[model samples]
Target: MMLEDLYRLLRSGHVQAQGVVDTITQPIIVLDQNLCVVTANNAFIKTFKADRDDIQGRVFFELGNGQWDIESLRQLIGGIIPRAAAVIGYEVKHDFPVIGQRTFLVDARRLVHPDDNSANILVLFEDVTERQRHDAEMDFIVSETRHRMKNLFAVVRSIAMQTETKGRTAADYRDTFLGRLDVTLRAQEISVSNTPADFEALLRQSVNPLGAERFHCTGPSVQLSNSRIMPVSMIFHELATNAAKYGALSGQDGEVHVTWSLEDGPRGRVFLRCEWREENGPAVTMPEHKGYGTELIQATCAHVGGMVELKFHPEGLNAVIKFPV
Candidate 1:
């Protein structure tokens, strides 16, 4: 019977029995004052895998080999329903005999007949397995985002404090700090997007602005880990900036060569070896003291468990960076 018909039956002071429940697609059951099943809808029959004849007029707990006879469930429907107006949003998660594990959100309401003081309990079941799974995934993503943001803030704080210590003047500090910050932002973008940071891609992002034709690079395809991507990119940014200002990239005839390889190391470890060579530039001379850019490169390499050797040849600047993989 449809709800319209059920409403008519109620108006005529006649209970339509279980047939009225079939109107709802959500698993539903009409129970008497004793909590015995009066009638179950088609949805309930299919969801619980029960015969209509076995369920009608039988106690709800006695259905499906007594799988529904749980302590918490009894407390909700048996203990609370008789005394309270209704029990709304009660959740039940259990494995049935043939249906396997499932989650359900239950809503039970006590309905008082207009003609009599006697009441009937209408229980509705909503399958929430998929909803709960989606909610769990969302929660995990939120938690991971918080964790990454915290880590990023820490990294920025470290950079600020260290830059302040090494910077010679406000101008130097602004330029150096902003350059390093750009590298950190790139790493964060890659991590959030869940994309692999290709070594070539990061190199281009750092140096291409200086001039794509100013540098020559040769290396096999390598994807960098999140922890290493920021530090490595910062190292390249500092080197490229120095080249653009004073090294090979400073002149039209000057250029830089960058090569890298992965090799086996002692103690069964792997190592990444990279070399930056510059040529055809102004006569090279070593600085009397370490500059902010040099310090930035060294500190970044140390953060990622790597080492860098900077040397000045008459031709140009040569730097070698190595790290364990």
Candidate 2:
């Protein structure tokens, strides 16, 4: 019903007005020209955890430890309502005594009784805390999706540029590039999926094709965040590829041992430390220059706030990768 109709009912009689106001679901209050509470709806009493007897005839600002004494609300009631006759959707955020934090869209309307020259202000409260939180969550999801897409594109471009095409035919180049792309896409899929990606599972998947017997892996269970998954997956893929080509996996008697642990770093930061050690491999020596694989590994590690250290000992190739979890 209109504010005028409600006001007319309220002016008619207190007993009848109480019944009518109680029917409304939204919390409402009627205040005299002096800002004293004339009557409050049952919804208002329930919503604010107030007693009707205590609120009636009390000043609005003095009620409930001065919670209602907000400066903006004072302005809306004293200054704006007098001139505008109505103030719609005046939002207020406050920590109420019993309700904790809440957001409300307040609508105030000035009411007049023509016969008696009486004036009162009608205030309506709409709880909008949940709606605001949902809106914020949607905005975050949209921003996160855009950011992930941009990063995915950049990663694809870098991988394409770094994939070596020299000393390879068109088919070989296509296979090599596509293999890396597949690994990247798989990582992206896992990162965006509803289920969290397991670090050990990811490592195993990257090196599983080389025969499980050629490698031994052990690590405590670790779950990776969405932002870290792609880069970590790429690091694992590169390390496995390099091992299969030039390290332990290249020889029949060689074996690779992968182990990882979580450690507390300086300043209480937790870090993931992984070691890739090869044994019984052909004599190893440091390359004269860094190859695309090595660069890719280093770049991916740096992308995730991590570092990779490679050691080409005479016996085998050893790598230590460290990054914040």
Candidate 3:
């Protein structure tokens, strides 16, 4: 009678828990209320680097730490039951012995038995390190694109305004617009499609027309990826044009100095700041009327979460920009 009862229990389908675990796409792991491993699917076995016989009863946190180290995984899994909330897409990285690289998105669900509310918890693991990285890379590209186009708009507006107020005739304004656009394009190309922008490269190009002898550059390894290049390029254009027209480039002996630095602010965040100062130039003054270029600079700088300041002294002009890197 006892053997028949046991046989009937095993054949009733209730004893075969593995069937449910085997169907999931994500790695599924189930543990009793004490957090001891009860069952793990093949996906789970492969993800955690365990054989069916070895991992059936082991703790969840034995995986080495760093990128996908199991200690973090344990904490994440252990909390799901207590917190009674589903955790989704938590990113982790690990260097596993069996696998050269491990990056995973972990998900967990607090499982309760229908007959016994406190029996066990279910955890799901999804490998999505590649997807997360791709998303971040795409985000950087999009941000860079938006920033660069905004600067182009500003540059065009500035050219239009400058021509409208001072041009001798329609053709003169048209030609000047075209010339300014050409200069802007050089920077725009670097902003939009260009993967990276060098501070020195922009300065060199801006001052190239006047001659390399007229422009000087100073900075460390400052490279802004596409996301930040757009505004930086616009600021470059403004300062370079101003120096050429009114500051050092305006005179034969004029000199312009450009430098950059990175600083750590409150709460350990890094930022970029650039300074432009002129030597041997006329006094600077705020324009009585704001021009299109001025508006463009101000608006675009603010749009990209940056601040711009322009100063005119008896000696020449100085512009400073500070922004998130």
Candidate 4:
């Protein structure tokens, strides 16, 4: 082709290339062999908050007050671009004046001009802030859930020891211990089948035998881990039992209110605070000695790193339990 025809062809290619780069949604920049920014797409300017005039033709490392001059990144691109097809999934964390600390996955490839054999680097950036945040939250939840499960298992071990002390023989111990174990296992199964157990559903199941009308349960829709379900259900069971035998649930007009709320606690940690308040019941007196039921409730609460306060008020019985969420 003639020189004029070749120039026209190159000019057409440049226009087509610019149109392609401009259409990309991800931040993209073209850099020369010396790491000088040859051109940047619209997405690049918008994403990094840079002007076309300020970035185009400038050294990439000097852009944005040298924010792009990452040492490890420079080494990565310098070493990989020449020998390999591309350097893919290179992570870069930068704090821009316009945007706070952000994470980006960068891909760089060598773009060669066939006519002159001159080469440039085409770099693409994908923002992964939301993905990283979601992964971190999921990891935390899994870890905490595992810790809670371990604590619950420890509580079961303690319960076995306590129950063993009251048994007359091996057979008696087996019967009593297994009976309590069965309750825990059943609760565990229920919770496992429905992971992140619904607070309202668990409460309803625990007090269903005592008659739902005897208890008024009100709380926000909160989900608790499987480990949390058994201990909490047991506490509710104990409360319902005591209510039916001696507290509010004993009388025809008596009632019990079980309300809970999630609130910020000390040091900015969040916790769930639940209250079991009885009303219009037979007068109650504080027990001098802690029974198995009381001990079980206290032990379970302590195992989960929680606090329980029980008050034998003249009007009725009130118990409050609070634990981290």
Candidate 5:
């Protein structure tokens, strides 16, 4: 039924008026011109955990130890309603006892008795706390996605600039740059996925394409935190790329052994130590000068508070990587 119909029933002193008001699902209260509670529906009493005897004659602002004495509510009812005669969806946030924090959309209307020229205000409260929380979470996700995209673009630019073109054909340069770019993007993807990236999974992603037979990997289960995943993944990628080009994976019957363990560090801190050993490839010799791949590997390791030690042995190459967990 409409507000007008309820007003008429209340004015006519119909016994069923209270029943009709109670039938409404939304919490509602009727107040006199002086802002004293005239009547409250079942929803209002149940919602606020109040009694009929305590509510009927009390001032709206003084109800329940003045929990309802909100300044915004006072201004809306005392100041705004007089001029507007009606207000719809006026928002109010309050921390209520028993219910904790809550947000409400308040709708109010001033109903006047035609014959007697007396007035009563009808107020309705709609709860929207959960909806607001969901909206806030969505906003955070959007902002985080934008930030990741910008970082990804910056990383790609760095890779393109640092990749060497000297003494290489166009196709060779293209392949090298694209390979690094692919590794960076893959790291980004794993970092953002619902499941967190782990040490073994990242290693497999970096080197499995070269053929699983080329590498034997064994390590204790270690979970990578979000900030550490990208750098650690990139480190593995660069190492694998180098192995494929000049170390174990480049020659038939060659193999790489990958293993890692967690160790206790100074001040009770924990660290991860990983070993990558290549064997049966071409005899190892130190490069005359540092290359971009070596620099990239070092940079990525340092990005995550880590370090790498590369050794050129007669059999092959061995790298020892250490980083904080």
Candidate 6:
């Protein structure tokens, strides 16, 4: 007879069932026609903390000191089977004496026994409490970020309104507002990407589009919060704009020295310091009038629990900013 005529499910008694059962990663529970545990995989034993001798011939629910009496979970799994299109899973809270309470993702499927018209169930699970918690936290962050951005826009509008009323002329107000927006945008650039980058790389990237070729920057490496890149970028943008207009960057020999390092950590205090200095510029002086850019730089630094020190010496303009680590 052709080999295709033979039954695959009716394995010979010599066939090693234990060898196959131990190889699966997903927890597998094979129940006999009576819905009694016939066998379980190593993965299943580890997951349920029940020994093979203890679980065999016993009902799955009553196997582990009745600890697996997760009602909704059993119902969800009781409905699924092999090649079945249903996506069934449940979260079960297990409170072991020493381990406290934890949530696990239990997924189950039923399979038709090839030899008999009976059925078997296989359950797989992983602890997903931490994952769920993290997802919730991330969602909160996203909502908070949107809220903060809207508030910031409102603040920008207020600055625009005040500057329009206070400026000497309409053109003066227009120039001031445009500069203000650019600074604001630059300060927020680093947060635009989800990736982490060193401080100097971030600053260099922030300054590039704003006529960076006309300027030079030097700095050492320092760790930085990914979200803080944007505000700092704006600060640098304002500083760069000022230099291009009236400071060292306006001159051929003008250069910007940007460096940073960590200081001794104080008790319960976390801080990092960064300095950006301008060189070979004409004499500098404070502006006769306050504008949005100046206010933005000060406010942004302060918001980050830090202060920005601005120095206008004959050589150039320099700024030192400290922020919470």
TM-score of each: 0.83, 0.63, 0.46, 0.54, 0.77, 0.48
Off by over 4 Å in 3: 1-172, 191-194, 265-269
lDDT accuracy of residue 105 in candidate 3: 72
- Best candidate, lDDT-wise? 2
Which residue pairs does candidate 5 place in steric collision? none
The digit string of per-residue lDDT tens for model 2 on 3-77 reads: 999988877788676678899999999988898999898899999999889999999888988988998888888
Best-first order by TM-score: 1, 5, 2, 4, 6, 3
Candidate 5 local lDDT, residue 231: 83
**1 or 2, greater by TM-score:** 1
Question: What overall lDDT, based on C-alpha atoms, would model 6 receive against the true structure?
Answer: 0.68
Query: Backbone clashes per model, in order?
Result: 0, 0, 7, 0, 0, 9
lDDT per residue for candidate 4 within 226-292, as digits (tens), equals: 7788888877877776788778888888899989999998888778899999998888888766756
Q: In order, what is each prediction's RMSD in angstroms? A: 4.4, 7.3, 13.2, 9.5, 5.2, 8.6
lDDT of each: 0.82, 0.85, 0.69, 0.83, 0.84, 0.68
lDDT of 3 by residue, 1-325 (tens): 6999988988777546666667666788877766667788878776667677766665555423332435666677677677776667777676567766767777777776566566577777888767877999999999998997897688688767755445257775575467567766776667657577776776677567664785677888777767766566666665666566556677877778778898865556567777877887555566666654566667667877778887766676677877777
Candidate number with the higher lDDT (2 or 3): 2
Deviation in Å, model 5, residue 237 alpha carbon: 2.0
lDDT of 1 by residue, 201-282 (tens): 8888889989888788999998887667777788899899999989888888998899999987777767789999999988
Which structure is stronger by lDDT: 2 or 4? 2
**Best model number under TM-score:** 1
Q: Which 10-residue span in candidate 5 carries the lowest summed lDDT? A: 78-87
Report the number of backbone clashes for model 5: 0
Which pairs of residues collide in candidate 4?
Answer: none
- What's the CA error at residue 13 for candidate 6, in Å? 44
Q: 76, model 1: CA deviation in Å?
A: 4.2
- Give the backbone clash total of model 4: 0
